[model samples]
Target: MKIHEICFSPTGGTKRVSSMLSRALTDETVEVDLTAREVDFGQVELSPEEVALIAVPSYSGRVPTVAAARLAAMHGNGARAVLLCVYGNRAYEDTLVELRDKASGAGFKVIAAVAAVAEHSIARQYAAGRPDAEDEAMLRSFAARIRRKIDDGGLDEPVIPGNRPYRKAAGAGIVPKATRACVKCGLCAAKCPVGAIDAKEPARVDKKRCISCMRCVAVCPHHARRVNRLLLALVGRMLKKACSQRKACELYL
Candidate 1:
């Protein structure tokens, strides 16, 4: 049986956690990058004997819309899926349950689930430098348990936390844009997972298409793309209390 690491990470946090889990599971693993704008996940087929680790970052208590769309296009072909929802130290809310349902809907059988903490893609102050030593240990332990379960031919579905008909995504109305320092390098446009930015112009952004995943901000070499500082401050203040307390990784096997 093979392992597939399918990840949608806008700011690298989700990818980091996913990688740890995949590596711990086995040395032979193939990756499916959900953030690539040019790739279609539908073409990536999975066999019944394979297993997939579907990892996605939670956005406003739910899966990012663009990521969900990309995931829905995938063909699981009855492979077992281990669902993971990585959040920015706040709460995964319905992200895990939603992912479980989505993966199952796409033809994967859900075997286990996890909700992990990562540094906020926007608010760097919370859960900063995480998936640290402690987090790494947790991931390894969980991977060991998973390895045992699969070896025993256990296919029992895991019961994960979250609500169906998930919470409405009331996203923070903070869209980032290129500042005067922007050199019009077009890198953001070329790399945008949703193709929201115009490749030729690079300055203009299609707000309607943007999911506020912060990929552009994190990828900018010149530090040009940024959200409004005043808005970011307000967001920081709003999340400060909830994010101040450190949360531990939760696993459901």
Candidate 2:
């Protein structure tokens, strides 16, 4: 069956995780970039005979609002989907469940789900080099199991994680700030998914439009952009207990 891999990854963490899983599942994969600016969601179409491996990063415990909107515009064409939520070492919270619901609503059968960890989007120290060798090995094994289940026609229910009423969407603060090293190259402004940065002055961020995805921070050539260092340090300390170990990638097929 054809495999459709759809994802929204700004800094490439989510894309990396999704690519690993896609490679394990099938060599015949079609990719859809949900992060493209001026995306025409109506252009995307899936076929009933295909299987879709849909992945997205958890932006503050929820799907990126813009990505969700783009996903909603597509017709699944009866494809069965493997919903994946890739996150920083932090918790995925309601993202997986929300994705499941969205995929189902788009007329795709929910056959499996996964929560994979990648380096923190804002703070790189956490989960660095992840979907690393260990994670790749685990994903390969999970893909084999998924293939077996499909072969057996096993469409049993899978337990997806999340509460019935999802936690409220996280606040949209934590805007990235540029350091003295910035060259005013405007790369961040050009690459921002939401036009949050001022194109003429790369260092100037439009806080109201920023989603705190940290795309600018990750893409900066000079490593000039960063979230508030004090805030990140405090957050890191508070979450240290919860972030002690990287969790194994799970599959529900």
Candidate 3:
């Protein structure tokens, strides 16, 4: 069957997880990059003959607002879907359920789901060097199981996480700022999904437009980009227990 691999990855972690899952599933894959700056939601469409592997990063236990809206705009054409929520070692809380609802609403049949872990987006030290060989092997086995289910037409009731009324979206955190080490490079601005950064003056960031994906901080060559350290510290402390534990990557098929 045809495979459509859709993803929204601001800091690369989500994309890395999605790619591994897609590779395990099939070689014939079509990627739908929701992070593209010039996306036209109306242009994305799926056929019933295809199987959609819908993957997105868990942003504060929820899907990114823009990614959700874009996914909602697409017509799934009755395609069966494998919902995946990739998170930075922390909790995935409501992401899987929310994504399942969104995909189902778009006319896709929910056949399977996964909650995978990658390196933390904000704090690199947490779950560093993840989605490594071990994780890849696990995902390959999971894909094999899914393939068997699909071939046998044995998909059972979907088991997605989260309550009926999903949690509300979290408030935007402090926007990242450039430090003195910045060389006026415009990479961050050009790669920003929302055009939040000023290309001419890379230090200038539009707080309202920034999604706090930490893409700027991760991409900075000079390590000049930083968010409010105090806020990050607080977040790290709150999620320390969850982040500290090395959770296994999983698949529900």
Model 1: lDDT to the true structure: 0.90
lDDT of 2 at 38: 75
Residue-level lDDT tens digits of model 2 in 95-182: 9999988888887888889899998876677888887999999988898988777667766658998976888988777898999999
| TM-score result, candidate 1 | 0.97
Error of 3 at 145 (Å): 0.8
On lDDT, the leading prediction is 1
In order, what lDDT does every prediction score? 0.90, 0.85, 0.85
Model 3: pairs clashing at backbone N, Cα or C within 3 Å: none
TM-scores for all candidates?
0.97, 0.93, 0.93
On lDDT, the stronger of 1 and 3 is: 1
Q: For each candidate, C-alpha RMSD in Å?
A: 1.0, 1.7, 1.7
Tens-digit lDDT track for model 1 on 16-55? 9999988888898899999998896889889888999999
Cα deviation at 217, candidate 3, in Å, is 1.8
Model 3 scores what on Cα lDDT? 0.85
